[model samples]
Target: MKNQKAVLVILLSNVFIAFLGIGLIIPVMPSFMNIMHLSGATMGYLVAMFAVAQLVMSPFAGRWVDRFGRKKIIILGLFLFGVSELIFGLGESVPVLYLSRILGGFSAAFIMPGVTAYVADITSLKDRPKAMGYVSAAISTGFIIGPGIGGFIGEYGVRLPFFFAAGIAFAACILSAFILKEPLSKEKLAELANNQAQSNFFYDLKKSLRPLYFIAFLIVFVLAFGLSAYETVFSLFSDHKFGFTPKDIAGIITISSIFGVIFQLFLFGKLIDLLGEKKLIQLCLIVGAVSAFLSAVISGYFAVLAVTCFVFLAFDLLRPALTTFLSKAAGEEQGFVAGMNSTYTSLGNIVGPAIGGILFDVNIHYPYLFSGVVIIVGLLITVIWKEKQFSQSLAK
Candidate 1:
């Protein structure tokens, strides 16, 4: 039991470090834009580049987690994360920035699946949800805390936060290499090797189109899309519209994350039990869509904070609700399902920020209003989704 608890700690730490790398650069993006004399479109593309890299790397990374073992893959991912942060900090050229984002995305693709599969490999079924919640919190809280750190760090030097991020990521990578162990037994590794056809990314991507999974995957995509649209341009938007600085953006995001953490810890499982994943998903979409639209019109920093907190709250709930829904359906095919989940998420991340950035270039408020429209489309899909019979079919 002690060993099990220790392993969970390592897994959560790995998850947190990976996401921290993502949040570390967000608040400082406006600074990067100014330094490069770039536009909102470029900022959006920069964010998309990471997703593009993750999209490209996820399939191979999924395969490697099984073939190479989880511990090794995580170390490789952390090493890449540290290097990516270093590049983004020091590199002056626009192309170099893109390269850093892509590398960072590759690190995310590698780390998430490795950590997730490792958690499942070690935890008992009864304790899985609790363990998974901690992992999810680590993921969300890491990203939330990152912007605050970056924002404050940016006060020192716009580029300093990245260096700090790199140093921290490297430390984690070293710790992981020395401390983490493979969770899977040798017999299980051999079993997974022989069953590659079942867990392969290509196979899962192809199967993701089944009516039941397709609707759920669509929800995931829309959630990613809407959230990215709101977030990628947020610092830029607040900077332009409200004349807010990196410090302000950091504080707002920090407060928003607190609300999300509250919901995630105290309310998440109870809501799942009471309302079920499907109903909770639909409720979150409504809140998300409303908040997205509200953000467009809200004045004053505090008002914006309130709306942003609700937006964060909706998305925070939406992610886990959908994850639970998918996990139950995944059954023996968790590996494949995870890859497909990342694929859909990456596709949404790639498109949303690209489009949101373009729209922001045209008009600062368009992205928020546009994000609302996109999420409403998702809510409509949930409204029409009729999965009761399909779920029963799987039972038989």
Candidate 2:
């Protein structure tokens, strides 16, 4: 138990560093677009390209994690992440940027599923919610710190943030190479090995993820889709609508990240215990939809900021709640389920940015309006979802 706890700490640190590297690039993306003289649609495609690569690779990555162990996959992912960021920092042309995003997506496919499965391997069912909460908090913390730091560093140059992110990711890769150990028990490892040996990846994946699990995956997709649509073009919207610079955008994101960290670390577990995952998910979806809608119509900076805070808080609450629910329903296929979750997320990311970019070209308000509508549809699905099987599985 003590050993598991120790490993969990290391896993949490890795997630923090990984997310930090990713977040460092967010605030600078608009600047990069400007430097390249890219259109809104082009920018959206650039963002989506990363997820496109991730969607293609996630299924295979998940299977490999279960087969090869988590540590090895994480190391490889971090190395790729560092290389991709470095390429983006140094690249001179649009094709090189696309290549960078492709590598970044591939890196995400490995890192996200591996970290999720690693957490599941080490934590007990009762402790899983809190563990997931901590993981979310770590991710939020990275995002919280990343943009502010990135913005400050970006004062030097747009490419500086990417280079800085590369440095952090490379350092994390080295740290993880030495510190991270496989968290699965020998019995559990043998079970996974035997399962892999008996069946092919697709067969096992299809068999493991039941119908209810598909619904869970769908929910994750909708959440990611809406959020990505809003996020991918957010800086563009703010810059156009409010005459905000990169520094101002960075400040807004920093505030949002602060609220996200607070909610994830302190309120998420308590809220889950109070409302249950079903009710919590439903409530958050409604909140997200309303906030997105309000942000679209509102005029002033403060009103926008206030509404966005609610949006960020809702997203923060929803992530850990939904992840815990999915992890509970995963049964013995933790790695595969986590991979599927990442796959669905990547799909949303791909579609969301593509749609958002086109909409942004037409009208600045369209992306937020579209995001709100999609989230409402997601809410309706969640409201009608039959959770009996999910509940029964979690009870075990």
TM-score of 2: 0.96
Model 1 scores a C-alpha lDDT of 0.83
Native-structure RMSD, model 2: 1.7
Q: Which stretches of candidate 1 lie above 4 Å from their native place?
A: 197-201, 387-390, 393-396
| Candidate 1, 1-396: lDDT as tens digits | 998898788778877876776677778888878998998898899889988998888877777777668888889989999999999899999999999999988888888778877776776554555566677778789878898888878888989988988988899999988898887777877777678855556675778887757889898899889889889889898989999888888888888888888888878888877886778889999999999999999988999999999998898888877766665666655555666777788889999999999999999999999999999999998876876744552353
Report how far off residue 137 is in candidate 2 (Å): 1.2
Identify the candidate with maximal lDDT.
Answer: 2
Q: Estimate each model's TM-score.
A: 0.95, 0.96
lDDT of 2 by residue, 1-396 (tens): 888888888888878887888778777777888888999998899889999999889988888888788998898899999999999999999999999999999999999789989998788888899899898888888887888888888888889989888888899889888888877766777778778777665775575456657667788999999999999888889888998777787788778888888888788888888998888999999999999999888987778778878998888888888899889888778887888888889989999999999999999999999999999989988866777866775765
| Candidate topping TM-score | 2
Alpha-carbon lDDT, every model: 0.83, 0.86
- Point out the worst 10-residue segment of candidate 2 by lDDT: 203-212
